[model samples]
Target: MTVTAADTVPAATLEPPTGRLSPLQQWWVLTTRGLLKVFRNGEFIFAFVSPALLAICFYLPLREAVAQVATIDYAQYLMPVIMLQSAAFVASSASMRAAVDGQEGVHTRFRVMPMPTAVPFLARAATNFVLLLVALACGLITCLIMGWRPVPEEYGGGVTGAAIAVLLVAMIGMALTLCADGIGLVAKSPEATSQLVAFPTLILGMLSTGFIPLNQFPEWIQGFVEYQPISQVTKAMRDAIGGILDWQRFEPTLWWTLGLFAVAAVLLVLGTRKAAR
Candidate 1:
């Protein structure tokens, strides 16, 4: 006997099963999704272009002067520093984007999702770190094209040193981003936020070894400059990727970076909690 149409319920009309991902899985998915967004955004190219171009232009005339005092190529010496500068910019931009997202209610949506609390910020940090690495690789290639050839032993040591320095910088970036995200929440407008972030960026970039060597400054000013986190990181980066490996110089900077990261961790926790409320 044929069943009446009203008596037979279709399986498709039933509610679909809602599957939730584990915390770790959710974090991974969020991170991967963030990375994909970065790739699709054409942001990688835009991020690297200005810095790379400026580095090339700035190094051209200095090549001869650099060759006179050192056996090593000056472009190679400067490449790491340029990478640091570019990475800092990329990190700041990432933070700014996060702030924008928060302002636009995107972060709020993520908060309601099944994702972990840490995923959004961590995903931003991961994406920024990857972009920074890409910028570094490109900077290195640019150096090579400019006739900078690194010695094998020196290269290995430099790589190790650069890695350490970058790790610290990434921590600093994440911390700053968290702080910025908090600031963005309260700011009445994006323009206000931009104005707030600009000076610190300029001051930190200039005061550090990013633009010029620390020794170029007067002796009395050197003490304060050396103590600043930017200075320490830049010094560590420069020592790692530029000249001879010196643990004496490297150790202190490394410690300072770690200390800054610890402080940043505290700030981030407080900031995120505040933002949540």
Candidate 2:
């Protein structure tokens, strides 16, 4: 029991447990990790490629045909829908990411961690926001290359209008991403998530006025086509870019986006609770 100097352990002073990360810091770390995952999985590449493909597919074959019927510039007319399509792509990716996280128990792990309950969801939202921006940028570039211009003659929105158009896209895109992410959290698998996301996106995008003028649609379903969320949001962005955005033009889109935000919030809460279980 003779304690030698060598055996004398200094009173093992414990460094205070490292301070917990602030919510912002926690969100940033999670967001960075999510972005890295997105890049490695090649979603980043698709963010660029998908829009380009969409532009070519729609603008090349249909441009001439569209011109024969409507006196509008196909590229200009098609830009808003294309932008919305890019948002849909982002939403699909968000859905898959959330599904994968849930399937792999990432959310469950977060539930046990010493962070706010909302951090993980917020981080996912931040990651989706970045991807949405990338998708939007690619969509814009593709449209520009295909002859869509931000000229006053085309949209008449000028700089102010262009800014509004961007804001509208961001708003609608985030709402879509959040909603898709919520669905994804409860999805059984990424495959299922993709199917869930694709069906509505296809139905909405194809039926909307993005590819053609509303007047061109058959008289039967034009009312549904006009009032649907996709068409309304697309019209808002188009008019904003054209510098003609007004309460009358934007009211429906605003309502739709708000409704989507509320739905997404509820779904996310349920999803988080499900993950905790």
Candidate 3:
């Protein structure tokens, strides 16, 4: 019997080159794919829209209303919360991406492929990080147009201090993206992940100093409003931007960032294990 060319072939040769790509290459490929999806799906269009909405909807109406009592620059005050909100945006999108991948069999395909375990998750995170930056940049521009300036008059850290503050916000955002990935992996459905994420983000954003100054809150819940993780982050970011970061205000925020790292790590393990099973 003639085996022909088909029988002579080692079948493995036709398989995808998962093994051929180095870890960095794999990460890059996955990152690019994620970014492409973000661009093509038009997810980022809303990133721009949100900042505009926040700028006009909340900023315009609330500016003078808050000033009558507080004497604070509302745009500057709202900027940190706006930036932090972008972090949550990235996380929600990350979870959605994870759910879509699982729903579409991309996760299953990754399991069968011979790639590092971290590649898939990290790639998604990296993509989210990029989007986070873009979203925040858009938010920053909107805030600036609304008269939010990063002048270091209070903290006296000046331009350098302002840069550090931005860096800190960016770092916090990266950490949040990781946390989102963990949640995404565990929930395994975009809808569940978004619902899971929305509660804390909303509660914290509303209650935190980023939205309303701590002193402005009612006496009863002021303690929680002051020390909650989002509040701490917002306060620290505000001080950092103002060039007024002293060790006292900086320490707790650092610890909170570390805590988020731990949460992300644990979730990643649990979600990956479930996927493997």
Candidate 4:
């Protein structure tokens, strides 16, 4: 039988799950479903291949030329941003997944089910986090293949050094995912959400210090390049690995990241209300 929205239970019944699984368990069930969809759609392979491809595409043509400009091996200079490219990919994937759910009225159905209010958000976040981690691993392996290492003076001081850099990058990746997921909910279609995010990702990724250094940019725009979020993250990760990360350089980016998280939270609240209606 075809059931209309009027036939569905009210949001009151969606109160936190009671008997079967705890709220946490209910959330995990949805999370597992999201993860399975990702795997079945072959996003897993793309998640791995996209980062490696970014590393290769940038490293091949510009290595020698950029080496002279940055005064470091181009591979080392390009390393952080390469991982960032992967992070962006993961963020995009988050949007696609959320948009799919929204379009299919999955959020609407969940709202009427007997689960906690936060379950949908948590389930989406859990799936995105796992995929982001996988993307990070793929990016690391790709960088290593192209000559990035934890050399004390160069790449990283070893595990400790790499950890610091990775932590910062992970935080940024999570923040981006939050915003993208919100966008997906609002857009309510996979294609729409993906299209909406592409411009910002392309502009920020290219116009920042990801591929080219600050000095390489025009004098007038150099400040913008230095201050942008992507450049800040790339600089933070690079400095951490090199054992030079400090409050001064990282502080602004931290603030920007926090602001982004706040924006995402507000958007999510609004989106949930929209889905409920």
Best by lDDT: 2
Model 2 scores a C-alpha lDDT of 0.88
Worst 10 contiguous positions by lDDT, candidate 2: 6-15
Q: Give the per-residue Cα lDDT of candidate 4 at 47.
A: 85
lDDT of 3 by residue, 145-206 (tens): 88887775655667676677777778888888788888877885788888888788888888
Candidate 1 residues 1-277, lDDT tens each? 8898655878666657777787777767777887787778776776667466757666877667656655645665565556556655664566566667667877668778767788776776666667766765665566566665544453454556556545655555555555555455455556776766666766866676554556666888887777776776666666655445478876776676566566556755764665566
TM-score of each model, in listed order:
0.74, 0.94, 0.90, 0.90
Give the distance in Å from residue 178's predicted Cα in candidate 2 to where it truly belongs.
Answer: 0.5
Instruction: Give the C-alpha miss distance for residue 241 in model 2, angstroms.
Output: 2.2
The CA lDDT at 201 in model 3 is 87
- On TM-score, the stronger of 1 and 4 is 4
Q: After superposition, which runs of candidate 1 have C-alpha atoms over 4 Å from their true positions?
A: 1-16, 22-25, 61-73, 152-189, 192-198, 242-247
77-170: candidate 2 lDDT, tens digit per residue: 8888888888999999999989988988999999999999989988998899999999999888888888887857453987678678878888
lDDT of 3: 0.82
Model 4 C-alpha lDDT per residue in residues 1-277, reported as the tens digit of each score? 9998756989877688655888988988999998999899898899889977887778988888887766787777788888888888988999888888888898899999888879989999999999999999988888899998875754455667678888888888899999999998888578889888777988988999889888888899988888889899998887788887889978977998898899899889988888889
RMSD of every prediction: 4.4, 2.2, 3.2, 7.1
Candidates sorted by lDDT, descending order?
2, 4, 3, 1
Q: In candidate 1, how many Å is residue 120 off?
A: 2.4
